[model samples]
Target: RLEPGGLTFTLADGAFGLGGARTPLDAPLRGRITVEGKDLEGLVAVAMGPEPRLGGGLKATFSLAGTAGRPVLTGEVALANVTVTETNPQCPEPRRRTLALPSVTLAAGWEDGRFTGRPLMASVAGGTVTATVIAQVDRRITVQLGDLAIRALPLERVLVDFLCHAQAVSGPLDLTGTAAFTAGDIPRTLSGAGQVKIGAGRIVGVQALRMLDAIASVAGAVGTLLGPGTPVSSSALAEFDSITGTYQARDGVLTSRDLVFNGRAVKATIAGQYNLASGALSFDVVAAVAGRNVRARVTGTAAAPSVSVVPASLLSPGDAGRIEKGLQDLLKRMR
Candidate 1:
């Protein structure tokens, strides 16, 4: 109802707001909005297009002030039983699956064309996701994520269900990173640096593991003398005790120099670049076993990578010497 004091209106779902401005667009505005258990899907669609389908109940209490042209809003929003589904062709199968986020709470504000959500927290698959989001809407929308931390997040939920990637790794994942990307093209313009750790897992379809498996096949002659318990195998999967890495991404290219994969029988280090836009891989994997290194060059796309052991002719003098010494030691043990 419009009165001399201001305007007070009640929405369909018992949502209510009161504004204290003489004119609807005048300055010195004072308003408070309370919405309870409203459908989040409609709100999300209105704010962020209709691509990612969201389902949830949203509860919020916001204080609104400032002029119409540059309105300021501060609020606390809570979402319950949220499920989000979107298209991701990169996944192995069922390219679209719903991700259930049990709870999400945000301490947020908006001023002018910018939205800031500090300490946005979500509960996903028995883990916690925390991040600070800063989004600015101007000529093009830009989002900056700060203090992002994902603790013990399940790989199946993110990589398989959400991201839709063919590669499989099962474990609790811990990651801390900060990233900035454009709203429409995150894969093309994303830039970030982070450290990631996956605890006690089995990895398959990873290029490094593929290289290690190939190296074992090439050394099958030695494996025959070592007996059936030898680590040599053509199987493309590995049980890793832990995989830890620090990574940096710039303009859709990810580069790492010290990614270490620790397995019970073999350990490997990866150093190189992977192009996110084209899924091209250009990396070197060095698997260490019995104090010797089996080096391989990794190339091709992420979907189908090729690994070839680096010939002794391509190795440095020190690497060649180490390989030769390792062979001599193995022969002595056989005698």
Candidate 2:
């Protein structure tokens, strides 16, 4: 029926291209197989599964079979980044679906029987998403994330060069988490810790000031006026709160923070259990920004371990002035 797990024909002569050419999204397939790589070890194994369902018209499955020493094991599947728009003129700007991708030529690698380099070279909503991974091949597998790049690269790949320190500000945003399966369990238990490398890929100076609001007092303070002479409302100098929140997850854990918008720094954590058999998302996340101590309790499952933030402080107003000027000057060196 098939060659010794390498690549061969299955049934019809139309060349079904089973193993290597298939992806994880295409599950339980039975077709022809043929792969052309460097060596046999590099391409550990090949398989197919059901097409996974994401947010939009994202329908695709993935096939995995490789190790870190080998890199990639599966083949590339065709992807479509298409947007739908209604052509009617009078219908309130018509219905539009957006699909943004920055670069072309997308592919993935394999590390220890797991998939690597997924959702690469794509941009959406001004923020980027990508992953870096290192997986172990076994009956009970354990996978570790080298990095998770939100604004630049993928999350799994970023773990290699970054660390999970909640209070430090270096990289723009960092995501650190893990996945593991114990012995003799019906399913697997996946969970890990999270934190961020603050100020990594911020755009402007006001962004930095807002981040510090959670730990320190901002220099510029403005208020809104009324009765024909109200200050144009452009002045965002009012004191705000910090970002301190928590969450509990189901399939995994999810912790989120809205620090950049609130004019302050923040700290959030998401951790808990996720039952795949049941559709449940629970978590615990924390956020603290602008001298405001806060903890937001959430019950949603966002499976990845996250980055945490540490509190920051300055001595006095004079110290703040020096720090501010010095920080502005240091911007040249920080980024």
Candidate 3:
């Protein structure tokens, strides 16, 4: 029997269960609902299925209003134990594993075909991230990421997740950035700007530190003045105390400026452009050590970058000798 009800009628408030449902990704969804006339509320819980593309547990508390065709929703979404598997064919086996994300909290809303979220915060392995996001009906999205504080975050994890690299670098990372793009054309339409700072980190899997070690050895020979101990190992790891830089993205190319890295025995200033679409990298790095400047050109993909160091040069022979002597004297006192 069907009873006809008016356009407006208050719904009885009670607990209700919905099951055997699936989301757009075909993930299993189960929820409980409570309703009162135009105002409706529900708690939807999602379970990770066999989907390899996405796996995570999510719980959302949402309130809805208006008719079924045009409804407004406001809610807070929380994500836990989420893991996104790498799907790129070029990614190595070591980097193909799942990338785990820390728990996330989002204040979200949807109205008139537009979605918005603010104060989206996450607590990850070594730091905290907060951002704001907005997506319009036309499929354009904008994101603003605030200062993300990093403390002792594992370099391997960061590389695999963000840079799509399997190499390891250990350190604390601090950064802030913003990005905007249309979902219709992702790689080409993406644009962003950011500043990054890494403190007390080591770069592994590259011989970029060899020049530093050589300089240190030369300094050590002069008046028994020891340079910063050889932090570079045979396994190709270079240790650095700090790196700071600013970056901008336009037309799929990310350009870095005023990038500086302070190593144990050498200091480097880097300028480069990375192609977001092709993963190509071209960097001009100048390493200064023992009063000599060594220019290194780094080119290739992020997955396997190549570095070529030019011959070291002295700005002025007289000045170089004086500087070398001053450094030797300082090292002697430190000893």
> Which candidate comes out best when scored by TM-score?
1
Model 2 residue 45 CA deviation (Å) reads 25
CA shift at 301, candidate 2, in angstroms?
12
State the lDDT at 238 in candidate 3: 67
Off by over 4 Å in 3: 1-52, 66-69, 87-95, 137-152, 160-168, 182-187, 206-237, 300-315, 318-335
Q: Estimate TM-scores for all models.
A: 0.79, 0.30, 0.65
- Candidate 1, after superposition: displacement of residue 198 in Å? 0.9
Question: What is the alpha-carbon lDDT of model 1 when measured against the actual structure?
Answer: 0.75
**Which scores greater on lDDT, model 2 or model 3?**
3
lDDT of 1 at 32: 78
Compared with the true structure, all predictions reach lDDT values of 0.75, 0.34, 0.59
Q: What does candidate 1 score on TM?
A: 0.79
Location of the lowest summed lDDT over 10 successive residues in candidate 3: 36-45
Error of model 2, residue 218, in angstroms: 23
